[model samples]
Target: MTTIDTREAAVAGLALFPPSLRISALESKNFRDEVGLSVDAVIQLDEIGVAFRRSTLFKNIRALLSENVASAEIIDRNNQSWNIALDKEKHGIRITAAERTYLIPDFSCLHPNVDNRLAWFDAETKRHGVSDEDLRAWRRILADREIDDEEVDGLLKQFRLTPRYVSAAIEKSLRRKNIRIDALIPDEVTYFDRLVGKPAPEHDLKQFFEHTTKERPGLDLPAAFLLSSHSFGPQSIALEAVDPAKVLEFFDWAEHAGDRFTQVGVVECGLRHLHKMPQLAPHLRNIIQTIRSDDLTSETGRLELLCALIMLVDGELARTGICRERQPFWRRLAAIAHASVIERAIVAVNMLPDDFIAWCRQSRGLHFYLQTFVDMRREPRWSPDLLSASQLKAEFIGRIVAAAPENAGTMLGDGSLELFDRASSSSLVAQVSFPFSFLPGPLEGGQPSIATMPQEIEDNLNEMLRSETLTAKSFVTLVNSALLYPLDGEFARLAAEGLARAKYELPNIKSSDEAFHLLVGLAIVASVTRSAKLANEVKILMRAVRRKPDIEISQENAFRICLLAAPASAGLSDWGKYIGDCATELSFEDMSRDSITTLWNFIEVLRQLEPTLLQTTSRADAALQAAFACCPPEVKTAEAS
Candidate 1:
């Protein structure tokens, strides 16, 4: 059993480090003499081994050899016996008379064979085994044989520089043979024996200081420094406890660091406590404003700054003590910064036309910003300005949409439509228009040709929708607006005709497929419009289209169009025929699996608006249940779990 030191045990917990860990600090002379002489022998063995053993070097090696050195006794500096024999068979070293042998690569050398020797020593030694500090010392000597070994030599001075010590020493003894080993050792071996340490990166003086946190009275601060005017307090009072020196130090590190990752770390550390320092709000505001567009685009810097901003704004609003008026300024600053990050990312996507689809497909770090924006807008202090967020989101979406059609190279992914749901649901466009009009920039009333100028507003909106960014409510609004456009008919036909002809490859052509879907959705809206001339005609056409079988279409597609035409507000009776067809298809175990899910969502939509539909789609519901039963137990469990 090993005895553990109270202090070391406290730091190490249950795990105890070996005694060798403190070898460098050990002041014992026996350890020093034995270790130094052994190290010298190893160095000699590295040189002319055969010649040294046969001549004067043999005598020097013998002078330092103790009875235990050549014996099986394995005791460390503590005088505890560690019964382990050195293996001369391993490395071609011979020990005469004593059965105990010394391995050429023993504790004194930096060699792989040392692991076994250390293990043996550890198993046999009592009290505790050698600590890492002792091993480190041995390694250092082995790493560079030329190092002036204090531990081993210091052992000799205290124990007496006797014939045993002198003879045991691998280097020649000046007193006995009047020979200097340094002169005898080759220059090549000496040069190669020196150790080279790893170089350190440049560090600044500002990093030297460390702050200690302690509770202070009356100031409401969590802590204070003995020599400083500044103190630590809650984040909302950040401005009051401002430490210009610490903040400046952080800024200096961020500005000077070559790696963006390091700079971002510094930026985060600097602003992490901002939520606790409301007094420092002005400085925090300045920092946010000073952050460049390039830095926001940087992989490292953006997330850090975003986290800091979120904490700052959210913390301030959460506190009941803060001034209500100050909330809007923080909210607006967060909003503008959030918007700017997305705007820059979208701009970057636009610049790459040929790779636009792939570019947009990549993660643009928008979710974090959008999430922060959503959370901030949810706070009671700023909820009334929900219009501000809606408008910001709308303008961003509109700009993206308007630009898409014009930029031939830039295309959207299937997922691009999703962003539209988010934007429209937030009513970002209307909100944005409250401050700035939704209309495109123009000189007077003359409208610019959509052909020449990029319609980024529309393009970005489409991109979001195709990406599935838009919610159902927002999608409905977009479809409704598109139908009201005088050119809705032409646009719908153009999109449908493109899909019909398979004008572009599905994977290569991104924007067109979504455009086709939007057009189809718009056509549905157009047919439902209650206008003077087309209302009756549109109803007649819907009925006619339902009954007529255009040979160009499949039964599957016809049913899908019917379901598409079925509004969320449509009653169960209205969707009975379409739901029946969907159930029948699902029953046949057809390849159109996705159609079943689509029908389910549509049915769900109607169920919410028309409860009667839930009763009407009984067969559809049963078939869905059966299909789900046919799935594997794991799948069922996954769904249930």
Candidate 2:
């Protein structure tokens, strides 16, 4: 009906059509016109893949062209109508519009091979002014099925022209479905044929693991190990009950598995799980024993066994709802830490790298061992006599001191110096008080002998004093002749010097409380060494007791020492003075309830020791009256007096 410029007509025609139809029509335009058809005939061609004879195709094509609403016509160079042709035998179509003639082959002929027919159609659609994206959509249509008209209409509603857009969208949807369905098509025969050949690839474990990982990422290391070890199904709970032998086989496989760190992690995980199995303990123990005995013959085996032992002793395990009887883990540990065995364990520990050493040190069991070793010196020996017990304790302590890792001698006499230094640098003080050891039986004079302990007593004492941690009570205990055996004059002098140095080292001791307490204890020892005035100096230092000083313990301690140091020469007269001092310092207002009780006890001991003091100054009489009043009623009046 009308003629338009070639380029203008093509652009105008695309604009007249919906976007989806424009693209499809542009691709099939040459094919349609080659068979002398209008645009509607090309639209129908885009939907179905069926081919017809050229004569019949042309006749149908002309009917659609004659109804052209755009009123466009084919033209030549002279602006006249052009001839079109169709060769249905070859499925070839030729079109003449304006001065140009376009040849269009059937879609089947366009692709060189049937296998790539879709790809060729996609390429041609793109070349004929269809956008790259629309061409892909068209391919999807041809490839898919089960696409419905509603979905096509929904796609068309997004545009202005509904009718022209729906067909191509439906075709694209079908193509997509076809492609997917094709991929889903099974090769059952091929799969069975593969299985029929031989056994499967170790249950295809490696591939299955890879597939699982690719499908679901972020598995924990140990869990991944378990997964790779067995054909665990998709159900995690069900898979959890996998055969132990299969799991162990996976572990065995991992033993010689590649040198990947993952392999090691997996094997270690399996071993740890094995350790936790209650039923497997005996078996595992046997294996460990075997390894311990013979594994050392090979370096690698030894290392592995060592590593396994470390894990065995330390691993935290999950339970399978089973209860087990406890073993004597502590006794075993004691045997391990024994002098003979300890050296080997220590040497083994040292041979390991520093990180391993740190790990061992951090181990709960190993840390506990270190603490026990430090404390072993103080453990009491079963003594028949208090004196013998003391002797044995000292001897044991001496051996421990000898074991000190060098530099232990410096602070042994009085740990106060090191204590002061440590306190200045650190926030907390570590003080250990070792109990006294006395001979089991009394001497002819009923006095306990302090000397028979093992040589290790002094050595261990020195070791404790030399510790970076201070022993405040121990230092005072050793100094207090009232509390402990009086050291010889020479020993007393050395101790006094050591205490003096500690005072100087620990500047934090601003009050005479500590210094005076220490001095009083020192004086008591001096009195034991035959010096009375030193005991009196202790009295002067304690004058603060009357004023309710914070150093009441020091005062009480000083008084106790005075009683201990009072010359067997002072006899009863000395007791008068001691009783007077005790009366002055042990007032209820001046001391705590416990301290007052302790004061009463001291008077009792003094009364027991020197009954004549009661007669000389009536000190014993006064003490007895006080004890009778406060003592718990147990028919002990005779015992009191």
Top lDDT model = 2
Question: Tens-digit lDDT track for model 1 on 1-641?
Answer: 99866545434532354566544323444644544422232224333232222223323233223223453432233333333334545633333323533344333221234454344334322212122333445444434442233343332232222212222231233223322322211112111111000111231111111111221212211111111111111112232354666655444433432122223222233344444433333432333223222333333343333333233323222222122232333323322222222222223233213332222213222222222222222121121122222322333333333322321111222232332233465322223332233432211011211333236535644553344222322344345343223223333343333333332222321343343354345334433331212222222333333333331333334333333343321233544444444445544443344555554544444343334546666666677566655653443335555
Local distance difference test, candidate 2 = 0.35
Where model 1 places Cα greater than 4 Å from the true spot, the runs are 1-520, 527-565, 568-589, 592-612, 631-641
Candidate 2 clashes: the total is 29
Work out how many backbone clashes candidate 1 has: 88
Give the per-residue lDDT digits (tens) of candidate 2, residues 1-641: 78656666666666888989876865574644554435322112223222333334444334333333222233333345544454455544555545766555433322224445465454444333223233356456545532232233322222311111322332343344332211211212221111111123332323433444454323222234322111121222121355666555544443433212223233223334443433333332233222223322443343332332222222111011010111112211211112111122323233333343234224433223222211111111111122222332232222222222233223222332332233444201121114432211111111223454345555554554454544345455445333344344445444444444444243333455665556545544544454444445444534533344433354355554444434422333553565455454444333444555655555544343334434443543364456546755445355555
For all candidates in order, the CA lDDT equals 0.32, 0.35
Considering every candidate listed, which one attains the maximal TM-score? 2
For all predicted structures, in order, the TM-scores are 0.22, 0.22
